[model samples]
Target: MSALSSSVQAVTALWNRMPFVGRVASQLTVVNIFDCATRLAAQAFLSAIPVLFVIGAFAPQAVRDQLVESLRTVMGLGGATLDQVQGVLTADSGNVKDASGAVGVLVTLASATACSRALQRVCERSWHMRSAGLKVVMWRWVAWLVVLLVALIAQGALHDAFGAGALLGIPVSLVASVMLWWWTQHLLLGGRVRWLPLLPGALITGIAVVALTWGSRLYVPRTLERSVDQFGPLGAVFTLLSWLIVFFACITVGIALGYVVAHEQPFDRWLRTSAATGRTDPADDADLAEESAQRP
Candidate 1:
């Protein structure tokens, strides 16, 4: 018992010595980062996937084709894997469009907002901010969906422009991801946090996005194909869900790490100096101090 107590004290002492990293670690524990990522993944899979299929049903043939092309580009889908997805989207599309009227479409879109709301909670928690009311953020939710869908489609074109290879495409994807995530944080937070402080998180998220996108190309296509062959559409569903979990886990970690980095020594000091120069809001310092005080 004495030995165990000594070890615990040593660990505590070590943690105390690294205040910045300790605060970050404490915040992550308080937020249950992995749990949050899993929830986001499940929410997105359940809500966003159905919404995408429904939207595809409503879309014209050309639009549906473009959607498949974008997915293929992003996931490196080919052969049987690509066919399974295209069939899912296009097989009952006409029937779906005919059966679902405007009301159905509206309902599908509203359900998709669950993903937006989940992501907004992540940002709010990372910043230790209160949730914005529905009225304040409802429009932002819909707008975010529109923006995300547009970006998804545009990603194919972005890759094609960069020689359709990972060499150049990686950098393009990283830059695009940074800009998109930066804007996403501001939009989802209802502009409560300024743009500059959000930079570290966005850059971290961008790197993660690029790395995952590149890496997924090597793994997802083969795994997807095998799953489809062995378990049909259901297998594909499971595989995609598993992938989404990993994807969101990395994203959550990146965002949390960004918060930590931005609030730690050199970066925190730099942000404060910038605030003094009128480049950033001095109010952010209070936010940092308050967050630290609340840390376990």
Candidate 2:
């Protein structure tokens, strides 16, 4: 516990010290944000095709009604707008038993593959690693996609478990969200450091994600209404992309923080001193490597 406490303290101190590192990290994220968001947006759009088919074609009326109720209750959507959104989400393709079609499956698979590939690239950049061999990439792609699917399903259960109606839900959701982010980070980037070291970053990311999810429900309907009124059906595209942008940006920043913290890079050292880059100094590259090797 003593060692754990010290490690946590070191991370906190470094985080408080590294505004410049954070700024540089932010710039780097901006460099990759558009590409990541585009891939994620494509995946979402493609996934909706199958989801709509399932809801409209195979789901019982009771299930559909429950879904509509959830949306209206959670997202503050109703009336013609809710109907319009539901209309767009629920497809008229296939029948009760055969809701999914060959085309829908093919497009969905392709979009998921693209998303995995894009995420692999982003993770590599975030971790400052050179690209891996095809086999490694392929394995990670499959694993990450499965993990993502699980996360999507689990979030509904999580929200139910940590009912947002009460004050208790806030801390419970934060812990749940942290666990989810930890799993995601480990899956997407592979282990470069001890898992415990990433907890602080995951904690921050989880809070941000939970906050955004709660806030988005309140904001998205209004945004959707405005977007549709001004841009017609194309407005939905704008609305979806805008949501993706915010999520992807937060994820990028969170991962960046995870990297720095996990590597035990003390940004406070940089902040505190105007030391010349003296290789002979104790706080040099060799010392950093030795410390990293010591981190187990």
Candidate 3:
């Protein structure tokens, strides 16, 4: 492990000396962001299916339309893709639907809960950090659900306050989005990273998320068109999966870039370097303990 770290440090030190693009390229190779993203996206999408079904049962037309439009903006779902999603979600059939929906909800919730745990593990792998204990499990859920609540409330507040004023609305929305993203990162990875070091990545992620949300209008429709032709209703599923993959990839890159920029030392100071908080890297802590054992 020490040898591998030494090699990575040596390569990273050299790679760091290169231009920004070169460093990013090297780090991207090191992180396996795409593989991690694919797993996250697939897991999330599969687990969301039954939740969508339950949501379909109670959500009003106006609510569903708003959601559909948001999906179009974020994942390019419209036309047949949009119709298919609603059909699957709102397959109403009285008691049969209720019974089946209840079962589906339980199964999907369990899957989503497991996948959320996997997501934490993936973050640890990507950032090369410590495993969390069962003690943190409840706190993690609290933090995550709190962020989701904040996001929803913020969206509603913004719309209610600025529904008529486009000139005043855009900046407010942007600010809200940025704040939401930052808070989300803080909650998601707070124990592993400090606030100061986490900001850059969170900001990058926020901007990327906004860009994706806006740009979905341009690309999502065409993608959805192709997806439907290729796989019928499943096309919406796959298209949504594709969007999720890119979204997670953006998140991984943001975290990595923040770490690269925040925690790395200059080449000249590498040997004597300490991290921002003057703490040993968690990755090296175990090895240091083991080495201490051998010395005595």
Candidate 4:
């Protein structure tokens, strides 16, 4: 009976610690914007190549021709004939699509390369120190890639089945987004901490990510449309900037949230410390530095 009581108390203590962890994560997220942005940009750029290639290869020839024509019109090259545009599109599309099969290989290599870089960036931004080695970093990236692919495929299937506007589809997407965020949290913090112990933080970060994603989908496109309507061509640039900022911000926040939840540290304390000292906690710093020091 005494042992059972102790076990129940231990569980209660852990449960009580979660909210504090979540708050810290949110605070840290706001503080580490630049670090998160650089890593995210690298990941985005690497991922985009494969995505574009897949789109170019799989999309119908007619669609590609239309896209090129639209670009020509946008560029005010009215004299640029459809045949010229079509020829260029055909050549480019072939090159892009022909590489589709290689995308997985490329993505794997790119993620491995980026993981070390990302770890370094995160450590430097959050903490003052760096770590080295690619083994754990590569594994983390691979894990994230697997989870991302699963989420994307599931989301795509849900969209196909119910359409995005359906009531059921909305909840399904929300759940999936949360899962993606949870998996991402797991990937990022898994090295220093056990996955099971970090469940609360992962869950909290996942919920926040889902909320942000849904909110952004509603607001961002409309905001872009309005800006374009008001500012003409220049609005397009602004729209792109807006999207990048929002995306980077959300990613940073999500990461911070996950970290806080897993560590149970106060967000403001870390944020202030990171800024004043220009360094994060030693534990967080160690993994990245270790990964970077590893030989290729």
Query: Which candidate number would show the highest lDDT if scored against the true structure?
Result: 1
Which sequence of candidate numbers ranks them by TM-score, best first?
Answer: 1, 3, 2, 4
lDDT of 4 by residue, 1-68 (tens): 99999999998798677767555644564345665664555565455445434545656775564454
The TM-score leader among the candidates is: 1
TM-scores of the candidates in the order shown = 0.84, 0.66, 0.71, 0.54
Winner on TM-score between 1 and 2 is: 1
lDDT of 3 by residue, 1-296 (tens): 99999999999898777767685665565556786678778767776666566556655655555555455444656787677776865566365356756677556556556555545554444444555566765467445643543454345334334465644545665677667655655555546554565566666766776666657768888887888898887886777788889988877777667555554555213422133223446667455434422321
Alpha-carbon lDDT, every model:
0.76, 0.59, 0.60, 0.50
lDDT of 1 by residue, 71-165 (tens): 77776677776776677678687787777777888888888888888888788777666667888899999999889888887777666654566
Q: Which ten residues in a row have the lowest lDDT in candidate 3?
A: 267-276
**Location of the lowest summed lDDT over 10 successive residues in candidate 4:** 73-82
User: What is model 4's C-alpha RMSD?
Assistant: 12.7
TM-score of 3: 0.71
Question: Residue 142 in model 1: shift from native, Å?
Answer: 0.5
Instruction: Determine the backbone clash count of candidate 4.
Output: 19
Q: Compared with the true structure, what per-residue lDDT tens digits does model 2 show for residues 39-88?
A: 66666666655554555665566555556655554344555667875774
- Give per-residue lDDT, candidate 3, residue 13: 92
Model 4: lDDT of residue 105: 54
Error of 2 at 266 (Å): 5.9
Q: Is candidate 1 or candidate 4 better by TM-score?
A: 1
